[model samples]
Target: MLIFSKAKLVFLSMPKTGTTAYETALSPFASQYVCDPPELKHAPVYRYNRFFRPMLEKFVSPDIETLAVVREPIDWLGSWYRYRHRPFLAGKPTSTAGMSFDAFVQAYCKGSRPAFANVGSQVNFVKPQPNGTKVDHLFRYENQSGLLTFLEERLGIKIELARENVSPAMPLSLSPEVEEKLRRKCAEEFELWESIT
Candidate 1:
Protein backbone atom coordinates (compact mmCIF):
# COMPACT_ATOMS: atom_id res chain seq x y z
CA MET A 1 0.00 0.00 0.00
CA LEU A 2 1.22 3.52 -0.80
CA ILE A 3 -0.08 6.54 1.06
CA PHE A 4 0.38 10.01 -0.39
CA SER A 5 -0.62 12.09 2.59
CA LYS A 6 -0.49 15.44 0.86
CA ALA A 7 -2.74 14.18 -1.90
CA LYS A 8 -5.10 12.55 0.60
CA LEU A 9 -4.86 9.37 -1.41
CA VAL A 10 -4.11 5.78 -0.44
CA PHE A 11 -3.43 3.22 -3.12
CA LEU A 12 -4.64 -0.16 -1.96
CA SER A 13 -2.59 -2.99 -3.39
CA MET A 14 -4.95 -5.54 -4.86
CA PRO A 15 -3.03 -8.75 -5.49
CA LYS A 16 -2.32 -10.00 -9.03
CA THR A 17 -3.65 -6.77 -10.45
CA GLY A 18 -0.22 -5.37 -11.37
CA THR A 19 -0.15 -3.25 -8.24
CA THR A 20 3.51 -3.92 -7.44
CA ALA A 21 4.53 -1.78 -10.38
CA TYR A 22 2.41 1.09 -9.13
CA GLU A 23 3.87 0.72 -5.65
CA THR A 24 7.36 0.83 -7.10
CA ALA A 25 6.66 3.83 -9.31
CA LEU A 26 4.82 5.81 -6.64
CA SER A 27 6.94 5.00 -3.60
CA PRO A 28 9.22 8.02 -3.95
CA PHE A 29 6.27 10.39 -3.74
CA ALA A 30 4.44 8.52 -1.00
CA SER A 31 4.69 9.63 2.60
CA GLN A 32 4.42 5.98 3.65
CA TYR A 33 4.87 2.74 1.74
CA VAL A 34 4.17 -0.65 3.30
CA CYS A 35 5.84 -3.44 1.34
CA ASP A 36 7.21 -5.80 3.93
CA PRO A 37 5.04 -8.50 5.52
CA PRO A 38 2.72 -9.67 2.78
CA GLU A 39 -0.35 -9.45 5.03
CA LEU A 40 0.09 -5.77 5.71
CA LYS A 41 1.24 -5.07 2.19
CA HIS A 42 -1.95 -6.56 0.79
CA ALA A 43 -4.35 -5.59 3.51
CA PRO A 44 -7.91 -5.67 2.17
CA VAL A 45 -10.66 -3.10 2.77
CA TYR A 46 -11.82 -4.72 6.00
CA ARG A 47 -8.28 -4.95 7.28
CA TYR A 48 -7.59 -1.36 6.39
CA ASN A 49 -10.82 -0.20 7.99
CA ARG A 50 -10.10 -2.16 11.14
CA PHE A 51 -6.43 -1.31 11.51
CA PHE A 52 -5.14 1.53 9.38
CA ARG A 53 -8.18 3.78 8.93
CA PRO A 54 -8.48 5.17 12.42
CA MET A 55 -4.81 5.93 12.74
CA LEU A 56 -4.64 7.52 9.31
CA GLU A 57 -7.76 9.61 9.92
CA LYS A 58 -6.40 10.89 13.20
CA PHE A 59 -2.87 11.64 12.02
CA VAL A 60 -3.38 12.38 8.37
CA SER A 61 -6.65 13.61 6.86
CA PRO A 62 -10.07 12.19 7.65
CA ASP A 63 -11.01 12.54 3.99
CA ILE A 64 -8.41 10.20 2.58
CA GLU A 65 -9.64 8.39 -0.51
CA THR A 66 -8.51 4.95 -1.63
CA LEU A 67 -7.63 3.69 -5.09
CA ALA A 68 -7.51 0.08 -6.24
CA VAL A 69 -7.09 -1.82 -9.49
CA VAL A 70 -8.92 -5.04 -10.25
CA ARG A 71 -8.19 -7.45 -13.07
CA GLU A 72 -10.72 -9.51 -14.98
CA PRO A 73 -11.67 -12.56 -12.95
CA ILE A 74 -10.34 -15.34 -15.14
CA ASP A 75 -7.14 -13.51 -15.96
CA TRP A 76 -6.57 -12.81 -12.30
CA LEU A 77 -6.94 -16.49 -11.41
CA GLY A 78 -4.73 -17.47 -14.30
CA SER A 79 -2.03 -15.20 -12.95
CA TRP A 80 -2.20 -16.92 -9.57
CA TYR A 81 -2.06 -20.34 -11.22
CA ARG A 82 0.97 -19.39 -13.23
CA TYR A 83 2.67 -17.79 -10.27
CA ARG A 84 2.34 -20.84 -8.04
CA HIS A 85 3.49 -23.07 -10.88
CA ARG A 86 6.96 -21.52 -10.64
CA PRO A 87 9.87 -23.88 -9.96
CA PHE A 88 10.63 -22.15 -6.65
CA LEU A 89 7.30 -23.44 -5.27
CA ALA A 90 7.77 -27.00 -6.54
CA GLY A 91 7.94 -28.63 -3.13
CA LYS A 92 5.55 -26.37 -1.28
CA PRO A 93 1.93 -27.12 -0.44
CA THR A 94 0.94 -24.00 -2.36
CA SER A 95 2.59 -25.20 -5.55
CA THR A 96 0.45 -25.64 -8.67
CA ALA A 97 3.23 -27.33 -10.64
CA GLY A 98 1.41 -30.36 -11.93
CA MET A 99 -2.09 -28.97 -12.06
CA SER A 100 -3.99 -27.91 -15.15
CA PHE A 101 -5.51 -24.45 -15.18
CA ASP A 102 -8.95 -26.03 -15.12
CA ALA A 103 -8.15 -28.05 -12.04
CA PHE A 104 -6.68 -25.07 -10.29
CA VAL A 105 -9.77 -22.97 -10.91
CA GLN A 106 -12.06 -25.79 -9.95
CA ALA A 107 -10.19 -26.06 -6.72
CA TYR A 108 -10.61 -22.35 -6.20
CA CYS A 109 -14.38 -22.69 -6.44
CA LYS A 110 -14.55 -25.33 -3.79
CA GLY A 111 -16.01 -24.57 -0.37
CA SER A 112 -12.65 -25.40 1.15
CA ARG A 113 -9.95 -24.56 -1.34
CA PRO A 114 -6.60 -26.35 -1.44
CA ALA A 115 -3.64 -24.18 -0.67
CA PHE A 116 -2.55 -24.14 -4.29
CA ALA A 117 -5.87 -22.57 -5.32
CA ASN A 118 -6.43 -20.41 -2.28
CA VAL A 119 -5.82 -17.05 -3.89
CA GLY A 120 -8.20 -14.66 -2.15
CA SER A 121 -11.09 -12.95 -3.90
CA GLN A 122 -10.47 -9.56 -5.47
CA VAL A 123 -14.02 -8.43 -4.65
CA ASN A 124 -13.45 -9.05 -0.97
CA PHE A 125 -10.20 -7.16 -1.16
CA VAL A 126 -11.98 -3.91 -1.92
CA LYS A 127 -15.48 -4.54 -0.56
CA PRO A 128 -17.16 -1.62 1.17
CA GLN A 129 -17.09 -1.59 4.93
CA PRO A 130 -20.35 -1.27 6.87
CA ASN A 131 -19.54 2.33 7.63
CA GLY A 132 -18.99 2.92 3.88
CA THR A 133 -15.21 2.99 3.85
CA LYS A 134 -14.33 1.67 0.41
CA VAL A 135 -12.22 2.25 -2.63
CA ASP A 136 -13.09 5.74 -3.83
CA HIS A 137 -11.46 5.10 -7.18
CA LEU A 138 -11.30 1.73 -8.91
CA PHE A 139 -9.62 0.94 -12.20
CA ARG A 140 -9.35 -2.06 -14.44
CA TYR A 141 -5.89 -3.59 -14.69
CA GLU A 142 -6.10 -3.67 -18.49
CA ASN A 143 -6.74 0.10 -18.55
CA GLN A 144 -3.29 1.27 -17.61
CA SER A 145 -3.62 4.59 -19.35
CA GLY A 146 -6.72 5.55 -17.35
CA LEU A 147 -5.10 4.68 -14.05
CA LEU A 148 -1.86 6.45 -14.94
CA THR A 149 -3.73 9.56 -15.99
CA PHE A 150 -5.57 9.68 -12.70
CA LEU A 151 -2.41 9.16 -10.64
CA GLU A 152 -0.35 11.70 -12.55
CA GLU A 153 -3.09 14.36 -12.44
CA ARG A 154 -3.85 13.71 -8.78
CA LEU A 155 -0.22 13.71 -7.67
CA GLY A 156 0.84 16.53 -9.99
CA ILE A 157 3.79 14.51 -11.30
CA LYS A 158 4.68 12.51 -14.36
CA ILE A 159 4.29 8.79 -13.83
CA GLU A 160 5.84 5.65 -15.28
CA LEU A 161 5.37 1.99 -14.35
CA ALA A 162 7.69 -0.93 -14.75
CA ARG A 163 6.51 -4.54 -14.71
CA GLU A 164 7.23 -6.12 -11.33
CA ASN A 165 6.41 -9.46 -9.70
CA VAL A 166 4.98 -10.84 -12.90
CA SER A 167 3.92 -14.45 -13.12
CA PRO A 168 5.56 -16.76 -15.64
CA ALA A 169 4.14 -16.69 -19.14
CA MET A 170 2.15 -19.81 -19.78
CA PRO A 171 -0.77 -20.98 -21.92
CA LEU A 172 -3.73 -21.34 -19.59
CA SER A 173 -7.25 -22.42 -20.41
CA LEU A 174 -10.30 -23.59 -18.53
CA SER A 175 -12.86 -26.04 -19.79
CA PRO A 176 -16.35 -24.71 -20.48
CA GLU A 177 -17.66 -26.86 -17.65
CA VAL A 178 -15.12 -25.56 -15.20
CA GLU A 179 -15.62 -21.99 -16.34
CA GLU A 180 -19.36 -22.28 -15.84
CA LYS A 181 -18.81 -23.70 -12.38
CA LEU A 182 -16.42 -20.89 -11.46
CA ARG A 183 -18.85 -18.24 -12.62
CA ARG A 184 -21.68 -19.81 -10.72
CA LYS A 185 -19.67 -20.27 -7.55
CA CYS A 186 -17.84 -16.98 -7.58
CA ALA A 187 -20.29 -14.62 -9.22
CA GLU A 188 -19.18 -11.73 -7.04
CA GLU A 189 -15.72 -11.83 -8.58
CA PHE A 190 -17.13 -11.39 -12.06
CA GLU A 191 -19.66 -8.83 -10.89
CA LEU A 192 -17.03 -6.71 -9.21
CA TRP A 193 -14.81 -6.73 -12.27
CA GLU A 194 -17.71 -5.80 -14.49
CA SER A 195 -18.79 -2.99 -12.21
CA ILE A 196 -15.42 -1.27 -12.65
CA THR A 197 -16.04 0.72 -15.79
Candidate 2:
Protein backbone atom coordinates (compact mmCIF):
# COMPACT_ATOMS: atom_id res chain seq x y z
CA MET A 1 0.00 0.00 0.00
CA LEU A 2 3.06 2.30 -0.29
CA ILE A 3 4.62 4.13 -3.22
CA PHE A 4 8.28 5.09 -2.96
CA SER A 5 9.88 7.94 -4.78
CA LYS A 6 13.57 8.87 -4.86
CA ALA A 7 14.41 6.16 -2.31
CA LYS A 8 15.51 2.56 -2.06
CA LEU A 9 12.83 -0.08 -2.71
CA VAL A 10 11.42 -2.80 -0.53
CA PHE A 11 8.61 -5.17 -1.31
CA LEU A 12 6.18 -5.42 1.62
CA SER A 13 5.24 -8.99 0.90
CA MET A 14 1.62 -10.06 1.08
CA PRO A 15 0.90 -13.74 1.40
CA LYS A 16 0.70 -15.92 -1.72
CA THR A 17 0.50 -13.08 -4.20
CA GLY A 18 3.58 -14.35 -5.96
CA THR A 19 5.49 -12.31 -3.33
CA THR A 20 8.24 -14.94 -3.20
CA ALA A 21 8.62 -14.79 -6.96
CA TYR A 22 8.70 -10.99 -6.92
CA GLU A 23 11.27 -11.01 -4.11
CA THR A 24 13.63 -13.03 -6.26
CA ALA A 25 13.01 -10.97 -9.38
CA LEU A 26 13.50 -7.61 -7.62
CA SER A 27 16.43 -8.64 -5.45
CA PRO A 28 19.13 -7.12 -7.61
CA PHE A 29 17.72 -3.57 -7.29
CA ALA A 30 17.10 -3.71 -3.52
CA SER A 31 19.16 -3.84 -0.35
CA GLN A 32 20.64 -7.00 1.13
CA TYR A 33 17.99 -7.22 3.86
CA VAL A 34 15.55 -8.61 1.31
CA CYS A 35 13.72 -11.38 3.09
CA ASP A 36 10.44 -13.17 2.39
CA PRO A 37 7.19 -12.38 4.21
CA PRO A 38 6.74 -13.87 7.62
CA GLU A 39 4.05 -16.29 8.89
CA LEU A 40 0.64 -15.86 10.67
CA LYS A 41 1.38 -13.36 13.42
CA HIS A 42 -1.90 -11.30 13.42
CA ALA A 43 -0.07 -8.12 12.32
CA PRO A 44 0.33 -6.72 8.83
CA VAL A 45 3.69 -6.78 7.07
CA TYR A 46 3.60 -2.99 6.65
CA ARG A 47 3.53 -2.54 10.43
CA TYR A 48 6.63 -4.60 10.97
CA ASN A 49 8.33 -3.31 7.84
CA ARG A 50 7.56 0.28 8.76
CA PHE A 51 8.84 -0.18 12.28
CA PHE A 52 12.15 -1.14 10.72
CA ARG A 53 11.81 1.47 8.02
CA PRO A 54 13.28 4.30 10.12
CA MET A 55 16.31 2.27 11.10
CA LEU A 56 16.77 1.34 7.49
CA GLU A 57 16.38 4.96 6.43
CA LYS A 58 18.79 6.42 9.02
CA PHE A 59 21.40 3.76 8.34
CA VAL A 60 21.02 3.73 4.56
CA SER A 61 21.03 6.49 1.98
CA PRO A 62 17.51 6.06 0.60
CA ASP A 63 14.73 4.06 2.20
CA ILE A 64 13.68 0.84 0.55
CA GLU A 65 11.03 1.19 -2.14
CA THR A 66 7.96 -0.59 -0.79
CA LEU A 67 6.12 -2.93 -3.10
CA ALA A 68 3.60 -5.77 -2.85
CA VAL A 69 1.14 -7.65 -5.08
CA VAL A 70 -2.47 -8.33 -4.14
CA ARG A 71 -5.04 -10.82 -5.36
CA GLU A 72 -8.85 -11.00 -5.42
CA PRO A 73 -10.37 -12.17 -2.17
CA ILE A 74 -12.18 -15.15 -3.67
CA ASP A 75 -9.33 -16.19 -5.90
CA TRP A 76 -6.83 -15.42 -3.17
CA LEU A 77 -8.71 -17.39 -0.56
CA GLY A 78 -9.28 -20.35 -2.87
CA SER A 79 -5.69 -20.38 -3.99
CA TRP A 80 -4.62 -20.02 -0.40
CA TYR A 81 -6.63 -23.10 0.53
CA ARG A 82 -5.03 -25.09 -2.24
CA TYR A 83 -1.59 -23.77 -1.44
CA ARG A 84 -1.82 -24.75 2.22
CA HIS A 85 -3.52 -28.05 1.51
CA ARG A 86 -0.69 -29.14 -0.73
CA PRO A 87 1.32 -32.28 0.03
CA PHE A 88 3.36 -30.58 2.71
CA LEU A 89 0.36 -29.64 4.85
CA ALA A 90 -1.93 -32.31 3.52
CA GLY A 91 -2.64 -33.57 6.99
CA LYS A 92 -3.04 -30.06 8.32
CA PRO A 93 -6.23 -28.05 8.06
CA THR A 94 -6.73 -26.04 4.94
CA SER A 95 -8.36 -22.63 4.53
CA THR A 96 -11.59 -24.55 4.84
CA ALA A 97 -10.18 -27.18 7.12
CA GLY A 98 -12.73 -27.49 9.87
CA MET A 99 -15.71 -26.09 7.97
CA SER A 100 -16.84 -24.81 4.62
CA PHE A 101 -15.46 -21.51 3.41
CA ASP A 102 -18.71 -19.75 4.30
CA ALA A 103 -18.77 -21.24 7.76
CA PHE A 104 -15.21 -20.26 8.39
CA VAL A 105 -15.92 -16.78 7.10
CA GLN A 106 -18.92 -16.47 9.40
CA ALA A 107 -16.79 -17.41 12.35
CA TYR A 108 -14.00 -15.06 11.33
CA CYS A 109 -16.38 -12.12 11.01
CA LYS A 110 -17.92 -12.99 14.36
CA GLY A 111 -14.57 -13.14 16.17
CA SER A 112 -14.35 -16.90 16.19
CA ARG A 113 -11.46 -18.98 14.84
CA PRO A 114 -9.67 -18.09 11.64
CA ALA A 115 -10.13 -19.96 8.41
CA PHE A 116 -6.58 -20.24 7.11
CA ALA A 117 -3.41 -19.73 9.08
CA ASN A 118 -1.98 -17.48 6.38
CA VAL A 119 -3.43 -14.33 4.83
CA GLY A 120 -7.03 -15.46 5.15
CA SER A 121 -8.19 -12.58 7.33
CA GLN A 122 -9.48 -9.29 5.96
CA VAL A 123 -7.03 -7.40 8.14
CA ASN A 124 -4.10 -8.66 6.08
CA PHE A 125 -4.53 -5.98 3.43
CA VAL A 126 -7.03 -3.68 5.16
CA LYS A 127 -4.48 -1.69 7.08
CA PRO A 128 -3.15 1.63 5.81
CA GLN A 129 0.21 1.93 4.13
CA PRO A 130 2.91 2.15 6.78
CA ASN A 131 5.05 4.67 4.92
CA GLY A 132 2.26 6.82 3.54
CA THR A 133 2.73 7.21 -0.25
CA LYS A 134 6.46 7.67 -0.33
CA VAL A 135 7.41 3.98 -0.48
CA ASP A 136 8.10 4.15 -4.20
CA HIS A 137 6.45 1.74 -6.64
CA LEU A 138 3.95 -1.04 -6.30
CA PHE A 139 2.90 -3.45 -9.04
CA ARG A 140 -0.34 -5.21 -9.68
CA TYR A 141 -0.49 -8.96 -10.05
CA GLU A 142 -3.17 -8.96 -12.74
CA ASN A 143 -1.38 -6.16 -14.56
CA GLN A 144 1.59 -8.38 -15.28
CA SER A 145 2.76 -6.46 -18.31
CA GLY A 146 2.51 -3.09 -16.59
CA LEU A 147 4.29 -4.49 -13.56
CA LEU A 148 7.16 -5.71 -15.72
CA THR A 149 7.32 -2.34 -17.42
CA PHE A 150 7.42 -0.54 -14.07
CA LEU A 151 10.21 -2.71 -12.72
CA GLU A 152 12.25 -2.38 -15.87
CA GLU A 153 11.70 1.33 -16.18
CA ARG A 154 12.13 2.16 -12.49
CA LEU A 155 14.40 -0.51 -11.08
CA GLY A 156 16.08 -1.30 -14.42
CA ILE A 157 15.49 -4.99 -13.79
CA LYS A 158 13.99 -7.44 -16.23
CA ILE A 159 12.55 -10.74 -15.07
CA GLU A 160 9.88 -13.37 -15.64
CA LEU A 161 7.38 -14.74 -13.15
CA ALA A 162 5.43 -17.96 -13.43
CA ARG A 163 2.12 -17.74 -15.32
CA GLU A 164 0.32 -20.09 -13.00
CA ASN A 165 -1.40 -17.63 -10.57
CA VAL A 166 -4.21 -16.24 -12.66
CA SER A 167 -7.25 -18.30 -13.56
CA PRO A 168 -11.04 -18.01 -14.12
CA ALA A 169 -12.26 -20.88 -12.02
CA MET A 170 -11.10 -21.19 -8.44
CA PRO A 171 -9.93 -24.49 -6.99
CA LEU A 172 -12.75 -27.00 -6.63
CA SER A 173 -14.59 -28.10 -3.44
CA LEU A 174 -15.95 -24.62 -2.63
CA SER A 175 -19.67 -24.14 -3.18
CA PRO A 176 -20.97 -21.26 -5.26
CA GLU A 177 -22.85 -19.82 -2.30
CA VAL A 178 -19.76 -19.88 -0.19
CA GLU A 179 -17.74 -18.28 -2.93
CA GLU A 180 -20.28 -15.51 -3.41
CA LYS A 181 -20.52 -14.82 0.28
CA LEU A 182 -16.78 -14.59 0.67
CA ARG A 183 -16.50 -12.31 -2.31
CA ARG A 184 -19.19 -9.92 -1.12
CA LYS A 185 -17.91 -9.90 2.41
CA CYS A 186 -14.43 -9.27 1.17
CA ALA A 187 -15.24 -6.82 -1.59
CA GLU A 188 -12.33 -4.57 -0.67
CA GLU A 189 -9.99 -7.50 -0.81
CA PHE A 190 -11.32 -8.45 -4.23
CA GLU A 191 -10.76 -4.89 -5.36
CA LEU A 192 -7.10 -5.26 -4.48
CA TRP A 193 -6.81 -8.59 -6.29
CA GLU A 194 -5.73 -6.97 -9.51
CA SER A 195 -3.25 -4.91 -7.53
CA ILE A 196 -1.92 -7.77 -5.36
CA THR A 197 -1.95 -10.92 -7.52
Candidate 3:
Protein backbone atom coordinates (compact mmCIF):
# COMPACT_ATOMS: atom_id res chain seq x y z
CA MET A 1 0.00 0.00 0.00
CA LEU A 2 1.17 3.55 -0.82
CA ILE A 3 -0.13 6.61 0.94
CA PHE A 4 0.41 10.15 -0.29
CA SER A 5 -0.24 12.69 2.43
CA LYS A 6 -0.42 15.75 0.23
CA ALA A 7 -2.37 13.90 -2.44
CA LYS A 8 -4.71 12.50 0.19
CA LEU A 9 -4.81 9.17 -1.58
CA VAL A 10 -4.24 5.61 -0.42
CA PHE A 11 -3.29 3.10 -3.07
CA LEU A 12 -4.50 -0.30 -1.88
CA SER A 13 -2.48 -3.12 -3.36
CA MET A 14 -4.73 -5.85 -4.67
CA PRO A 15 -2.83 -9.10 -5.27
CA LYS A 16 -1.97 -10.03 -8.87
CA THR A 17 -3.03 -6.60 -10.07
CA GLY A 18 0.43 -5.21 -10.97
CA THR A 19 0.67 -3.37 -7.68
CA THR A 20 4.29 -4.38 -7.20
CA ALA A 21 5.22 -2.40 -10.28
CA TYR A 22 3.32 0.59 -8.98
CA GLU A 23 5.04 0.26 -5.62
CA THR A 24 8.42 0.18 -7.31
CA ALA A 25 7.78 3.28 -9.40
CA LEU A 26 5.73 5.34 -6.97
CA SER A 27 7.06 4.44 -3.53
CA PRO A 28 9.68 7.20 -3.64
CA PHE A 29 6.95 9.82 -3.90
CA ALA A 30 4.60 8.36 -1.34
CA SER A 31 4.54 9.79 2.17
CA GLN A 32 4.20 6.33 3.71
CA TYR A 33 5.08 3.06 2.03
CA VAL A 34 4.14 -0.40 3.25
CA CYS A 35 5.93 -2.91 1.06
CA ASP A 36 7.53 -5.33 3.46
CA PRO A 37 5.61 -8.26 4.93
CA PRO A 38 3.04 -9.46 2.39
CA GLU A 39 0.30 -9.18 5.00
CA LEU A 40 0.73 -5.42 5.29
CA LYS A 41 1.60 -4.91 1.64
CA HIS A 42 -1.78 -6.37 0.65
CA ALA A 43 -3.94 -5.25 3.52
CA PRO A 44 -7.59 -5.21 2.43
CA VAL A 45 -10.23 -2.62 3.22
CA TYR A 46 -11.19 -4.07 6.58
CA ARG A 47 -7.58 -4.38 7.69
CA TYR A 48 -6.81 -0.82 6.59
CA ASN A 49 -9.88 0.44 8.41
CA ARG A 50 -8.78 -1.34 11.55
CA PHE A 51 -5.07 -0.58 11.59
CA PHE A 52 -4.24 2.40 9.35
CA ARG A 53 -7.36 4.50 9.06
CA PRO A 54 -7.50 5.87 12.58
CA MET A 55 -3.90 7.07 12.50
CA LEU A 56 -4.29 8.63 9.08
CA GLU A 57 -7.46 10.35 10.18
CA LYS A 58 -5.75 11.80 13.20
CA PHE A 59 -2.36 12.70 11.73
CA VAL A 60 -2.79 13.06 8.01
CA SER A 61 -6.23 13.87 6.63
CA PRO A 62 -9.63 12.65 7.67
CA ASP A 63 -10.85 12.26 4.08
CA ILE A 64 -8.39 10.11 2.14
CA GLU A 65 -9.40 8.87 -1.27
CA THR A 66 -8.69 5.16 -1.68
CA LEU A 67 -7.70 3.66 -5.01
CA ALA A 68 -7.31 0.04 -6.20
CA VAL A 69 -7.09 -2.07 -9.32
CA VAL A 70 -9.19 -5.14 -10.06
CA ARG A 71 -8.12 -7.57 -12.73
CA GLU A 72 -10.45 -9.62 -14.90
CA PRO A 73 -11.48 -12.56 -12.69
CA ILE A 74 -10.33 -15.50 -14.81
CA ASP A 75 -7.09 -13.79 -15.75
CA TRP A 76 -6.42 -12.98 -12.09
CA LEU A 77 -6.88 -16.62 -11.10
CA GLY A 78 -4.69 -17.74 -13.96
CA SER A 79 -1.92 -15.49 -12.68
CA TRP A 80 -2.12 -17.13 -9.28
CA TYR A 81 -2.16 -20.60 -10.80
CA ARG A 82 0.88 -19.91 -12.93
CA TYR A 83 2.70 -18.12 -10.11
CA ARG A 84 2.48 -21.09 -7.79
CA HIS A 85 3.74 -23.34 -10.56
CA ARG A 86 7.15 -21.67 -10.37
CA PRO A 87 9.97 -24.13 -9.72
CA PHE A 88 10.60 -22.70 -6.24
CA LEU A 89 7.15 -23.84 -5.13
CA ALA A 90 7.35 -27.29 -6.66
CA GLY A 91 6.19 -30.02 -4.24
CA LYS A 92 4.72 -27.54 -1.75
CA PRO A 93 1.06 -28.00 -0.78
CA THR A 94 0.37 -24.48 -2.06
CA SER A 95 2.10 -25.16 -5.36
CA THR A 96 0.21 -25.70 -8.60
CA ALA A 97 2.90 -27.89 -10.16
CA GLY A 98 1.58 -30.62 -12.41
CA MET A 99 -1.95 -29.21 -12.07
CA SER A 100 -4.12 -28.23 -15.00
CA PHE A 101 -5.75 -24.79 -15.09
CA ASP A 102 -9.19 -26.39 -15.01
CA ALA A 103 -8.45 -28.37 -11.88
CA PHE A 104 -6.97 -25.31 -10.19
CA VAL A 105 -10.04 -23.21 -10.93
CA GLN A 106 -12.36 -26.03 -9.86
CA ALA A 107 -10.59 -26.15 -6.56
CA TYR A 108 -11.03 -22.38 -6.28
CA CYS A 109 -14.77 -22.83 -6.73
CA LYS A 110 -15.04 -25.31 -3.91
CA GLY A 111 -16.74 -24.27 -0.63
CA SER A 112 -13.46 -25.02 1.12
CA ARG A 113 -10.65 -24.31 -1.28
CA PRO A 114 -7.50 -26.41 -1.28
CA ALA A 115 -4.19 -24.78 -0.40
CA PHE A 116 -3.26 -24.23 -4.04
CA ALA A 117 -6.52 -22.37 -4.69
CA ASN A 118 -6.81 -20.39 -1.50
CA VAL A 119 -6.14 -16.95 -3.01
CA GLY A 120 -8.25 -14.21 -1.46
CA SER A 121 -11.16 -12.47 -3.16
CA GLN A 122 -10.71 -9.03 -4.76
CA VAL A 123 -14.32 -8.14 -3.98
CA ASN A 124 -13.71 -8.57 -0.25
CA PHE A 125 -10.46 -6.65 -0.51
CA VAL A 126 -12.14 -3.49 -1.76
CA LYS A 127 -15.58 -3.80 -0.19
CA PRO A 128 -16.88 -0.74 1.66
CA GLN A 129 -16.30 -0.61 5.35
CA PRO A 130 -19.06 -0.13 7.95
CA ASN A 131 -17.99 3.50 8.26
CA GLY A 132 -18.48 3.92 4.50
CA THR A 133 -14.78 3.91 3.61
CA LYS A 134 -14.64 2.74 0.01
CA VAL A 135 -12.48 3.03 -3.03
CA ASP A 136 -12.79 6.50 -4.53
CA HIS A 137 -11.07 5.49 -7.75
CA LEU A 138 -11.11 1.90 -8.99
CA PHE A 139 -9.25 0.95 -12.15
CA ARG A 140 -9.20 -2.17 -14.28
CA TYR A 141 -5.85 -3.89 -14.34
CA GLU A 142 -6.00 -3.97 -18.13
CA ASN A 143 -6.32 -0.17 -18.22
CA GLN A 144 -2.78 0.71 -17.23
CA SER A 145 -2.80 3.90 -19.24
CA GLY A 146 -5.99 5.10 -17.64
CA LEU A 147 -4.62 4.41 -14.16
CA LEU A 148 -1.34 6.14 -14.96
CA THR A 149 -3.16 9.17 -16.33
CA PHE A 150 -5.24 9.45 -13.19
CA LEU A 151 -2.20 9.10 -10.97
CA GLU A 152 -0.11 11.62 -12.90
CA GLU A 153 -2.88 14.18 -12.80
CA ARG A 154 -3.70 13.52 -9.18
CA LEU A 155 -0.14 13.43 -7.89
CA GLY A 156 1.37 16.00 -10.24
CA ILE A 157 4.16 13.71 -11.40
CA LYS A 158 5.11 11.72 -14.46
CA ILE A 159 4.62 8.02 -13.78
CA GLU A 160 6.87 5.34 -15.16
CA LEU A 161 6.37 1.70 -14.16
CA ALA A 162 8.48 -1.33 -14.96
CA ARG A 163 6.78 -4.71 -14.98
CA GLU A 164 7.43 -6.57 -11.74
CA ASN A 165 6.31 -9.74 -10.00
CA VAL A 166 4.98 -11.26 -13.19
CA SER A 167 4.20 -14.96 -13.20
CA PRO A 168 5.69 -17.18 -15.87
CA ALA A 169 3.71 -17.25 -19.10
CA MET A 170 1.75 -20.41 -19.86
CA PRO A 171 -1.22 -21.38 -21.97
CA LEU A 172 -4.20 -21.36 -19.63
CA SER A 173 -7.43 -22.94 -20.73
CA LEU A 174 -10.39 -23.53 -18.39
CA SER A 175 -12.99 -26.04 -19.49
CA PRO A 176 -16.47 -24.64 -20.01
CA GLU A 177 -17.93 -26.62 -17.14
CA VAL A 178 -15.31 -25.38 -14.71
CA GLU A 179 -15.61 -21.84 -16.01
CA GLU A 180 -19.35 -21.93 -15.50
CA LYS A 181 -18.91 -23.18 -11.96
CA LEU A 182 -16.39 -20.43 -11.23
CA ARG A 183 -18.65 -17.72 -12.60
CA ARG A 184 -21.57 -19.01 -10.55
CA LYS A 185 -19.57 -19.36 -7.37
CA CYS A 186 -17.63 -16.12 -7.70
CA ALA A 187 -20.07 -13.74 -9.35
CA GLU A 188 -19.01 -10.86 -7.16
CA GLU A 189 -15.50 -10.97 -8.59
CA PHE A 190 -16.79 -10.33 -12.10
CA GLU A 191 -19.36 -7.82 -10.89
CA LEU A 192 -16.73 -5.78 -9.09
CA TRP A 193 -14.34 -5.83 -12.02
CA GLU A 194 -17.09 -4.75 -14.41
CA SER A 195 -18.10 -1.86 -12.16
CA ILE A 196 -14.73 -0.16 -12.66
CA THR A 197 -14.75 2.53 -15.32
Candidate number of the best lDDT: 3
lDDT of 2 by residue, 1-197 (tens): 22233445555656656666665555554555335334422224556455655665667645455555655555556565556444445455443444455554454434344435334543454455634633244455567677677666766556776544332343356567766666676666666544443
> TM-score for each prediction?
0.98, 0.68, 0.98
User: What do the candidate models score in CA lDDT, each in turn?
Assistant: 0.93, 0.52, 0.94
Instruction: Give the per-residue lDDT digits (tens) of candidate 3, residues 51-158.
Output: 999999899989888899999999999999999999999989999999899999999999899999999999999999988988889999999999999999999999
TM-score of 2: 0.68
RMSD each, Å = 0.7, 5.0, 0.7
Clashes of each: 0, 16, 0
Model 1 TM-score, 2 decimals = 0.98
Q: How close to the true structure is residue 157 of candidate 3, measured as C-alpha lDDT?
A: 100
Question: Better model by lDDT, 2 or 3?
Answer: 3
Model 1 over residues 1-197: C-alpha lDDT tens digits?
Answer: 99999999999998999989989898999999999799999999999999999999999999999999999999999999999999989989999998899999989999999889889999889989999999999999999999999999999999887899999999988999999999999999999989988
